[model samples]
Target: MSPDRGDRRAVTAGFGALLSRYRTKTWLGGAVVAGLTVSAAMALRLALSPVAHFYYLPVMPAIMTTALLGRRSSVGLAIVLAIIGCELVVRRDSIADTLANAALFIVVAWAVAEACFRLRAALDAAQTMARDMARRELLLDSILTSTPIITLDCDGRTRRVTQGAAALLGVAPNGALNQPFETLLPGFGAAALQAAQRSDGASRTLWRASRRPNGDAALLTVAAHQLPDDADPEHTVLTLTDQSQAEAARRRERELNDRLSSVWRLNSMGEMAATLAHELNQPLSAAAVYLHTGQADLARIGPVAQPTLRTLDLAKAQLLRAGDIIRRMREMISNGSRAFTEERAAQMIRDLEPVVALIGQDTGVVIRIQTDDEDDHVLADRIQLQQALTNLIRNAVDAVIDRDDGQVTVTGRALGAEGYEISVRDNGPGIAEAQMDHIFHPMISTKTGGMGLGLSVTRSIVESHGSALAVSRPQGGGACFTFRLSRPTESEIP
Candidate 1:
């Protein structure tokens, strides 16, 4: 129940509590009022002694009034009034007549008081019983409304649709009532009904492929039973337990395990990269040395070998680039520390083309690199930035890997005068609405057996450089991941 509703009930129950405490009268208090009433009756009797001497007239009225006000007090008041009548209406001719009349009046008044008392008691008992039943009814209604069950009549018509069952079907309470049970669920047929009838009181699972009015499918653990009815018919009570939450929980657990396994796999790859970097650096250094020796030898051979010398110099430059790549890779694998450099966006895209090709080589998907017309230069940790871009592009490639017309595009461009933006997009099915929130979250993946770490690591890399990674589903039908980087400050600029 809502907090507001509970507060309202509490306020309503306490509203008259204080007044009720002061409204009750004690037995001593009732006797005090009765004493005052009898004194007034005595005064009226004396005043009428000279006029008419009618003792029974005032006594009868006092007896009835006391009976109505207080039952126990009324009996006492009646006995006192009878004594007053005896003293006031004494017969001078016969003592026996006066005594007999007084006794008879006492008996009649006592009986009248008791009859009124018994009638009042009966009314009080009935009212208390009604109040208790009403309270129980309210409690029962609250329970039934929230119960996770849908009751049906013997004729297979929906009689009650609980709030829980309505929520599972994505409808309002009473929305499916008075409808045929078979029509509500896809498989509530004769066979299922017969199984339920055989269950007696035990539960039996019934498959019902039910879709909500809004078209969202639901999985439910359905059970039916034939309630032993005292009437001429038996009711097939259908119980529905929503299995959506349980399914989601299992999915999440699996994702977590996959992510953990992925993390271990990533750690293993880093160790391998570190070892490979050491091994490759030795050969690359020797190759660069050989290229330098060749360029010098060609230089000494004069203008005849000018083309050869130029080619050797080019080879040496590429070798130096390779060495730098190995150094940065080792640094990133050991402890992620940024080594900022002035990097042209166009050059970065050019450097990524070969890697992009290799990624799509086996998958047969087309991957393209696009850059802005302007050669925008930004100060960034080139290796880390490239790693983040690589992760996003790989994710995009995976998204489109299954399609025959799969296409992945990586875009690096200037965001503004002082910033640059990099985006990876794929022409594949976009992320589901349910998984949108947790896509960047660690240990969450949509792909079967996916480690779910690429996006998470990419987001960390982008955030480390003071930017937020964002995602969107474009109208053209694909997922796009993007982030921005700041330009170098005036002091850091070349």
Candidate 2:
């Protein structure tokens, strides 16, 4: 059971085999025993009777036990045999000699037992050490095989990547064992080796690498640990994790936010259309009347009449204005499924014209556009910027639709080197101070039937374009929503 006991047994067996092969005479003790046996046999033959010297045979059992059995059990058996031998060989007629032989046997047996105890202790210690080694091996094997992270063992030039390491690294298997690590992982391997060398005495170290393997766009996060007593400082254990999935998830979240925002703007457009239909219908009816008058006058004159021509020109201008409003309305209602993207500043404002016109036509609230300082071109997605601006104008309209003084002012200007600012100011009830921060968050709206995604989406788009959107009360008790865009460069300023 014990390592020392087992080792001793193996050695003894091997020695016995070698001794048997030699075919030489036995050692001094064995020779003495053999001679004794011969003399006893001859003596028995001469006396014509049996000699009771069976005690001598006990030595054979003791020798065999010492070689084959473990220390404790063997020594115990030897001591018992020695006592029995003393009893068998010492004559009962000589009491003193018998006692002396028994005392001598105790002394020899005690010495043998002490030796056996020390050998047994040594064997036990060795077995315990072997068991501990086996346990550590099992623990390491489990860690290597079951962990999701990749692990590698390297000795500077050579690296051994275990099974599952390749899968984690998103790389095809190359013969990792005994091959140069650089050959397996190329550029990363060199950096990893460099990091490993620097981290030899460090308890913890982190390194970031932004590179795509095999032309794939992904970020790799590598972690390394140096092994104890490592001959080469560059020999380390490496683990790789890809951050591509996390980045993709973030993009998806942004897209979902855009879609939800688009939905909210559409909802607001519906309300705005309902609110402005009356005002727009009245103007359209008046324009139709003016056109009819101009047409009738031209028909009667049948030739170029200055007054009739002037009337016709005015009618044509009104018609164009009416047509522009209708066109803007159509664009607002016509939803395109293209994903929202960043667009230029000039392009973003230009796209909102149609939607702004539609809101003016559909709502009695008068809309005004003003610009003080000029702005450079900006980056924004066309439709998204359009939707955000549309939402702001509509919100302004709704805020003051019932008031005789209802006015929505759209203004723009440059903000130094940072960007351009486009603001929607309305003469309406201002937003409560408590609701400022929450206004941009989804599902927090003051309007009826509002999903509250309008402001939220607006902010998202603004942020995406390296811009910002904010809300505050204007000088005239009204709500104002302002968005800023980064200042454009020489090529982009147009």
lDDT of 2 by residue, 225-327 (tens): 6666543433466665555687679889997897698668667866686457545766776777777776776777766676777667665655655555454
lDDT of 1 by residue, 1-494 (tens): 45797666455444334323332256665565556556666667778878886655566555654554554764585567557654755454677866776677677777776775665555455545556767998998888777777777878888888887787766666668887777767676767777666766333463444676778677776677666675323376777776767777999999888778867877787798899999999999999998888888888889999988876776686688678878977887788766777777667767767667778897888998888857477777776677778788888888899899999988878877758888889999999888889898766788899867778878987887788999999899999998887777778665
The number of the candidate with the highest lDDT is 1
For each candidate, what TM-score against the reference? Answer: 0.57, 0.43
Query: Which 10 consecutive residues of model 2 have the lowest summed lDDT?
Result: 201-210
Error of 1 at 13 (Å): 23
Give the whole-model CA lDDT for all candidates, comma-separated.
0.73, 0.60
Task: Tell me model 1's lDDT, rounded to 2 decimals.
Answer: 0.73
